[model samples]
Target: MTSILLDTPNVPALKVENLVVDFKTKNGVVNAVRGVSFSVDRGEVLAVVGESGSGKTITSLTTMALLPSTARTAGVVEVDGHDVLNASEADMDSKRGNVVSMVFQEPMTALNPSMKVGKQVAEAILNHRGLSKAEAMARAVELLDRVGIPDPAVKARNFPHQLSGGQRQRVVIAIALACDPTLIIADEPTTALDVTVQAEILELLRNLVKETNTALLLITHNMGVVADLSDRVVVMNAGKVIETGTTVQVLTEPAEPYTQALLAAVPTLPEAQWDAIFAEERTGEPRHAEPAGNSPLVDPVLDMREVCVDYTSGGRKLRAVNQAGLVINRGEIVGLVGESGSGKSTLGRAPLGLVPVTGGEITLFGGNVLKASTREIRKLRSRIGIIFQDPGGSLDPRMTVGDSIAEPLVMHGVNGKRPGRAERDARVRELLEAVRLPAANANRYPHELSGGQRQRIGLARALALAPELLIADEPTSALDVSVQDEVLTLLLDLQKEHGFGCLFISHDLAVVHSVSQRVTVMQHGNVIESGLSSKVLQRPEAPYTRHLLASVPSPNPIVQRQRREARTALLLSSGTRGS
Candidate 1:
C-alpha cells in the first residue's frame, strides 16, 4: 500500500474554528452559516448534513475560499496547515484546485459542456503543475481510467451530455482527485443516481479515500449515506451545528432531536426490490379501483392503455417501456415505483406528450394527448405541472427564484389575465412563504438557495397555475431525507387541500409508501403490478417483486443488533468447541 501522509505531523487535515458566513441581501443580512467548527482527519469521511437553508454548502464553500466576493466571512479555516479563511487571492488561487478541490452536486453544470472533458481536466493540471498539453491530456486519460470509466481514451474525448449521470459524476471526481489533494469536498455527490449506482459511487469514494488517505468533507442530508460512509458527522440547522459525533453515535444515539428526525427520513427499500414486489403483488390479490360510489367517481385526468415506449441504440431495439397501462383518477395520488430504466419516467412523460408511445394509446381527461394540437397541448400544459428530479437543473440560474415561480403564472395569465407587476410580486412572495421559505429568498437566484429550498421553490412553481394533475418525477430523490420528508408531507397536504391528481414517480419504496395510496409497478415498459400500497408491499407474489422487497435494507435496529449478537455468539461457541 502507498503510504500517503497528511500535511501536518499531528494536526488534522482540516480544522474550522468559529466559522461564520453571512450574505447581505436587499432585506437584511441573512446568517447563512453561524459559528460552525469541526475537524477532519486524513482518511476520515466527515459528513455535514442539514436541510435547505441550513448552511451546509455555505460552510464548505467558505472554508474552501470559494465564496462570492459580496459574502462576508469570519472564521479560521485551516486546511493542511494553510489558513484559508483569510488567505490572500493569490495564495487561494494557487491552492484552490491543488491542495483542495470540490466536486459540486451537479457535475453537468460544474463541467464545461462546450469543451471536451479531458481537455478541461487537463487545464487544471496545466494551470497547477505547469504540465504540457500532451502530458496533461495523457494524465487526464489516466485519471479517467483511475475513476473506472471503461475505454478511458474515448470517454475522455466525449462531452458531458454524451455520458451517463454516474459517468459524469465519476469524471468530476477524477478531476477533483487529479492533483492528489489532501482534502476533497463533495456536496451531495450521489443526489440523482439510482440505488445500484449510488452503492457503487459510495464504494468508489470509500476505496479512493483509503487509497489516497484523503480527508473527505461530505455535505448531504441523507442519513443512509451518513450511516454507510461517514466516520464522523456534524448535524447543521439554520447555520449552526446542532450535533457532532461518530456515525454510529449520531445514527443510533443522536443527542439532538433534529439529528434523530433526519435519520428517520431516508427511504428504506431499494428500487429493484420494490419493482420485483410490485410485479409479484399484481399476481396475488390484485387491487382494482373501487367502483363508482354515492359521489360519482371522477374521470381519470390521465389514462394509459397498452402504452409502449421504445428506443433503438447501437443497432439494438430496446423496449424501455412495454405495453404499460394505468389510470390516474381525478385528485388521486398514484405512486409509480420501479428501478432505473424500468419505464416509470417513460409512463409519466407519456401523459405530457414528452415521450411517444409505440404500441398503445394515452388519453388525458377524455382527450387524446398524442393527438392534441400544439395550441391544445400548450393550453393543457397549464393545468398539468411537472417537477423534475433535480430542482437546480430544472430552474434557470440566470432567473431569480421569484421570477422563476412567477413565470408559469405569468404565462398562464393568472389572477385576471396577467395581473399587474405588484400583484405578481405579492403572489411570488406568498408562494415562497407557503413553501415555508423566507419571503426575502424571492430576490435570490437558484445558486443562492440550498438544494432543499430549490426543490421547494420548484414545487411552488409547479403549483403556480394550480394544475389538476401534478406529475412529480422523482421530485424528492435529490433532496436529503429530512428535507425529503418535508417535501413529501407538503405534497400530501397540497393534494389533500387542492384535490389534484398526483402521478408520483419514484424508485424508493419507503418514500412511495409514505405518500401514495395506490402503487403501480412497471418493468421494461410493462405494468407488472397495480394495487393498494399495503397489499403490494406487505405480501408480494412475484419472484422479482420479492427480490425488490428483500432489497430494502432492514431498518429494524433490533434485528440488526440481534444479528450481530448471534454472529458473535456463534463465533465464541465455535472457538470454545475447538479449544
Candidate 2:
C-alpha cells in the first residue's frame, strides 16, 4: 500500500487517466465512461461539452470519487497529487469538502428546503474547519456577498424557495466555494437560469476563478458559455471525447465534423439572417419556408378576447394575467415571449378553457367555449393539442410507447375506423415516422429512450388526433443544444406539411426567432410589444425587449472573442483605477 500526499512537484490541479465506470442493473452492466482521460491546470477553465448520455456527468462524478456502491470504477484520478480513486472513505472525506467541491445544475433540488441558507452553508464550513458557529456564519455571509447577492445578511436568513432561480444558484455557488477548494466542478450551473442571469453567473465564476487562482471544470451544453468562459473545450459523444482544444481553435477551425455540426446547430442572431428572414415575411412568402396547404387547417380552432386571470394570495390580489387576449387562427403559427411571470401560459390556456378567465370572451372554431358545457369542451379538446415542458412526466410509465401514441386514436373513435389491426399498426408507424423516430422504437418504453426521443414521442401523441392547432410550451428548453436543433427543424417541417397553426412559447429568444413568424413580448400580463418577427427582432423598441434580445447567446467566434477581450480590459483598467 502506498500513501499519497496533497502537494507534489510539477503536478496539475487535477488529472484523470484511463477512467472507466460501470453500473450494474437487472439486464446487464451499463458502461458509462470508458477509458477517458483529461487534465486541468491551476487557474485554468476547462469545459466538457456533450449531449445527454455522453458520459460527461459520469466522468466528472468518477473524478470526484462519488460513484455509488453498486457501481464499479477503475481510474487514476489524481488531484493535487492525491489518488482519489484508490483513497478510502475517510481519506476521501478529508478532501471532498476541502480540496474539491461541485455546484449541481438544479439549485432547488440541491438545497435543503427546511433549513435557512446561512445555516446550511455554515455547516459545510464547520465540517471542514475547526471554526466556531459564529465564525462559520460570518464566512457564509462573506461568501454570499462575494457571489453578488444584494443583501447577504438578510438573504442568509431566508429559505431556498424564497430566493429566485439566479439567487438560489448563487447560494449554491457560495456553498461550494465556502471552503476555498482548489478545484471546482460546475455541472450545468446555468441551465436553469435565464440568459441574462446566466451571463452574470458565468462572469462571476470566471472572475472568482481568476481571483482565487482555482481550476474550474465546467460541464455544459451551451456553446456560447463555452466560448466566453472556457480557455479549453472538450467535445464528448457516446462515452468518448472526440475533440479537445483551445476555445479559439475549436470555435474558429474545428477538425471534427461533429464539432462543426454542433457549432452550426447553435442559433446565432446575425443581423443579416434576421433581415433576410424579415424581408421574406415582408413579401408574404415567409423566409426559408415551403408553402404549406390550408387543407389540414380547422375552422375556428381556439379564440379568446379580453381574458384576465387573477389570484388572491396573502390578502393581495395579484393579477397574473390582465386583460390579455389571444386567438389561435387555424393553421396560423403565433409565438409568445415574456419574462418569468408575464401571463403567457395563462393566456395560452384561456382558449382551451383550462384556466378561468376573469373577464374575456373565449371561443373554439366560432363556438362559444367560454360558457360551453363540459361535454362540449371535452368533445373539442381532442381537436386542440398541447405539449408541455416535461415530456417524461407527461407520459405514463404503465403504458408502453405504442399504447401511449395509440391512446388518442383509440379514445377519439378513429382507431376502429382504420382498416384493421394491420392498418392501425401502419398508422402508428406513420405517426412515428412523421416525427423522424424509428418505427421499431414504438415497442420500447419511454424510460429506455433519451430526453429528445421522449419529447418526440410526446409530439407524436399530440399529433395523433391531427389537431389543427398545436400549443408547445418551452418544448426544446429541456433538450441539449444539438438535439434541440433537430427538434426545432422537425417542428418547422411538420407545421409546413400539416398546415397546423402553432403557438410556440419559450424563454429562449433564439429559438423563438428561428421558428416563429410573429413575435409578441409580454410583461406583467400586458402585451408590451408585438409585430412581425423580423421587425421586432431586428429593431426592438421596448426596453424589456432589448434586454431579452441582448440576453441571447451568439456562436460567432469574433463576437465572443471581442466580449472576452473587452471584459479583460475592463478588469485591468479597474485594477489600475483602484490603485
Candidate 3:
C-alpha cells in the first residue's frame, strides 16, 4: 500500500484541529462533534466513517462553514491554509466554491428543480469564475463529459427530473467540479446507487482527484467505500474521533470497539453459513418444511412465464421486462438481484397488477393476472403485499400509523365483513406488537418514528393482510448496517411465522445472499442467471454476474485492494477502461 502521510508537502490541502460543534436543542445542548482533528494533503483521500447521528456529517459541514445558525462551533478548520471556522461570512462565501466544495448525499434535493442541469453547473462557475453564460455552459458540458456522462450536449439541456438517479448524481459532481476547488467534500456520494454505477462514480472521483491533484474528504458509513477509495481513515462515534490511521491499518486492525462493530455489521458474500446461523436462531418449528412424504406436488405461489412489461417515454418504447420467467414456491424467498433499470422493480410489481404486462403470463395461485377482469384482479390483490424502498415516501404523512396499517384491512374487509372501529384498532395493535413496536406507537405519525422504526411500520402495514406472497423492494437499502441486520432478522422471523413466499428485490448482492434461498440475476430486462443463492452469488457462472460480485468492496482493506486489482484486470481483458 502507498504511504498516506505527506513527507514533502509544502502545505496540506485541508486540516482540522480540536474541532467541536454543539447544538442547543429543546432537550439540552447536543454535542455534535467533539475534539475531532484530521488532515488531507493534496491528492489524498481521507475518509471519515461512522453510523447515522455519529457526527461524521456534522464534522464535514462544520469544516465547510455551512452549519446552521443554532450550531455553536470552536477550534480550527483550515482549507488550503485558510481558517474556515474564523472566516467572515463574506470571506467564507467567496471561499466556498473556489477553495472548497461539497457534493451532498441526495442530489435530487440538492439540485434546483426549476433549473436545467447545464445551467445549474454553469451557475456555480459563473459565481466564482466570472465567465459569460455561453462560456460557462460550454465548460459545464465539458465537465459533464469528463465525469463520464454520455451525450453531454443533449443531457445538458435536460432538467434534473429527466435524469436517472445516477445521472443526477453525475450532474451534481459536475457542478462540484465547475470551480475546480482545491478540496472536495463528498458526503455519501454513492449511497443509493447500484453497485455498478457506484463503481463508475468512485472511479471517476479517483481519476479526477489524481488528474487535478485535488484533496478529497469523503464522509460515509460504507466501510467498503472507505476501503476502495480512501488513503487514510478516521473512525468516529457519538461526536468523537476514536481511531485514525492509514486505510490498510485502520480497516484491518481497528483499535476501537465501535469501528470493529461497524465492520462486523457489513454484509458479505458466501452467505450460506450466515443463513444457517439465522435459521438456528429462529425459535419453535422450522418455517420451511416439506409436506408429508417430502412431496413435490405443491405448486408455486407465484409463477411468471415469458413475462414482458413495456412503457412509452418521450415517444420511445422502453422494454422494462423482456420475456423473463421465474417461480417462487410456497414459503420460499427468491431474490431478484440486478442493477438499477434492470427491471427488478417492474417484475416484482407485475404479479400485483401494478404494472401491466404487455405479453406473456403471470399466475398467482393458478389465477391469471394479465387476463383477469378488474374485479378478479382486485380480489387477487388481497392475497398479495408489497413493501416499498422508501417508507417515508410510501406512507401517507397525513395519516397516523394505526390508520395507515388498518387502511388495507378496512378496504379488504379482512374477515369477509366491514370491520368495526374497535376490531380494526385491535388488529392494528396486534400488528404493532408483532413487529416489536410498542402499542402506544400506533398513534404516532410516520415522521415521528426513526428510520428503522418507520421501516418496521411499513412491514407491519404490508403484513397486515396476511398475504401469501410479499414483494419487498429494497426495504433496508436506506438503513444503517446494524439497523439493516435487525430489519433482515425481523423479516425472516415474520416470513416464517406467516409462511409467505417473498420476492425480495434488491441491488445489494450481499443482502440478497443473506436472506434468499434461491436467487435470480437480472440484467438489462433479462433474467441472465438463476439458481441456488450460494452457487449464483459465491460462484457466479455469467461474466456480468461475476463482475457484479467482484465490484462489491469488502471491509478488509487487503481483500478490497485485491478485488480492485482483479476488477481492473477484468476490465482490461474486456477491452474497456474504467467506465
Candidate 4:
C-alpha cells in the first residue's frame, strides 16, 4: 500500500485550482494565497513547504473553506469530489471530519482540556456516524490502540494535560483517523516534538497512508521532514507557488533561487567545521579569561559536580536529574543536548538554583551555590543571565520592551546601589542597539513585536546586566530556519562581544553543533556522553547518541528516503520479534 508514482487521481483526494485568498486588513488588502494550484492523490504525501507568511497555511484553509468573514477567496477546492469552494456552511461542517480532517500543530489547542481523550475521539465518530455512545467509545479505544497508544483503554480516560506532548499528538492523529478520512491535512505536526518523537509521528503518518490509502497534505517549513516524508513538494513563497516538482527534483535540483535559499538556511551537523569556528579571532575578553583561555585547566564560570534534582510527584520521589557534571570556561559555549524528559533542562537550571537540587555541588563565579544564602545567591546572580525558549512568555505583555530591558539593571548593580532612571535608560538604549533593534523599539510592547524581535528583546534584557555567564534554553527552536540562523549568528557575535560563558540547552543537534565548543549528551536524568562537538557529531560513541543522530531527518531527499526505508525495515523486524 506504499505510495505510487505521481498520477492524476480519478477522484482526487484533495485538489485546489487557481486558489486566491485575500483579507481586508486595517492597513490594506493582504494577499494570502495567489493562484496556488496542486492536487494530492490517495496514499500520496504532498508537502507544501514555506516559511512564515508564505501562504502555505492559507491554501490549506481555503480547501477546508474555513476563512473568516474578512477573507475574500476565489478558487476551485475539491475534497473527495465535493465542491468545497462553494459548499454551504452546513455542508462543509458535515463533510469536515467525515470526508476530510485536520491534525493541528498544537494538540493541546486542538483538544478540549476538560474532557477525557477517549471522549474527544468518540465525539468525532459521533459527529458523522449514527453510532451509540458505547459503540463510539469502544471505537475510540480501538483507534487509540491502532495509533500505537499503550494501555489505550486506561489512557482514554485521562485528560489532555495528563498526557505527554507525543501522546497528545497521537490522540490527535487518532481523532483525525476516526472517520476514515479520504484526505488529512497535517499542519506542522512534528514542529513541537523532539527528533525522536518526530520520527515516531512521521512513521505513524506513513503507515496510516499505506494502511488506509489516505492522502496526506503536509504543510510545514522543515525541509528535512519534507525530504523524508513527501513524494512531491510545492515550494511556496510570498503567497505563490514558486516551484512544484517531485521531492528529489525539488530538493536535489531546485529550479528556483528562492528554493535554493530556503534549503541553504537549514543547519547542518558541524563535523570538521568546528575547526573553522575555533580558528576565528574573538575580541571580547571575559573578566575571568585566564591566560589558559578555554583550556580545561582554566577556572570555569560555572561548574557542577554530581548534580541531581529530585521532585515529589504522586507521593513518590522522582529523581529528575541524576548525577551530572559539567563545566563551562569563560568565552566558551557548552551545549546540553537531549530529548524531552532527558534532564538537560534540569541540569541547566541547577547552576542558577532555579530548581531544588537534592545533591550536587554547583559553583558559579567561584562561589558555592549550595552553601550560598539567599542574599549571597542574589549577589552571585548579578553576574548570571538566562534566556528561555519562549521569549514572549518570559516578557510581561503589559510592560514595554524598554522597561523590560531596564528592569534587570534596576535590580542588580555594583556597590549594592541600584541604577537610577538616567543610568537605566542609557543602558536600555545601548542594549537594544546591541541586539540590532531600533532604539525607538524600546517604547513598544511585547505584543507589538514579532517572534524574532521578541527573541532579540529577550537577549537584550538577558545581557543588560553585563553578566559573565548566560544560560540559553531552546532560544531559537521556535523560529523559522532563516530567522534561527540570524539569531544564532547574533548570539555568537554578542557572546564574543561580552566574552560570556554560555550553557546552550537544545534538542536540536545541528543547532548545538553550530554553537557549542563542547557537547554533552543526556538521557533519562544521566549524562550518557560528552566530548567535542567535532568528535560527538561526526563519530558518536554512545548508542543513544547515535540513535539521536540517526533520528535527525537529512535534507537530502534521496538519502533521507533510503534511511526511511532502512528504518522501516528495522521497525518491522523489531515488531515481529516482540510479537
Candidate number with greatest TM-score = 4
TM-score of each: 0.73, 0.88, 0.89, 0.91
Better of 1 and 3 by TM-score: 3
Instruction: Please provide, for model 4 over 296-375, each residue's C-alpha lDDT reduced to its tens digit, 9 standing for 90 to 100.
Output: 63758988889989999899999999999888989999999999999999898887788989998888888899999999
* lDDT leader: 4
Superposed on all Cα atoms, model 1 deviates from the true structure by an RMSD in Å of 7.9
What lDDT tens digits, residue by residue, belong to model 2 across residues 29-79?
998888888899878999999888899998888767888987898878987
What lDDT is obtained when candidate 4 is compared to the true structure? 0.86
Better of 1 and 3 by lDDT: 3
Pairs of residues clashing in candidate 4: none
So what's the TM-score on candidate 4?
Answer: 0.91
Candidates' C-alpha lDDT: 0.79, 0.80, 0.86, 0.86
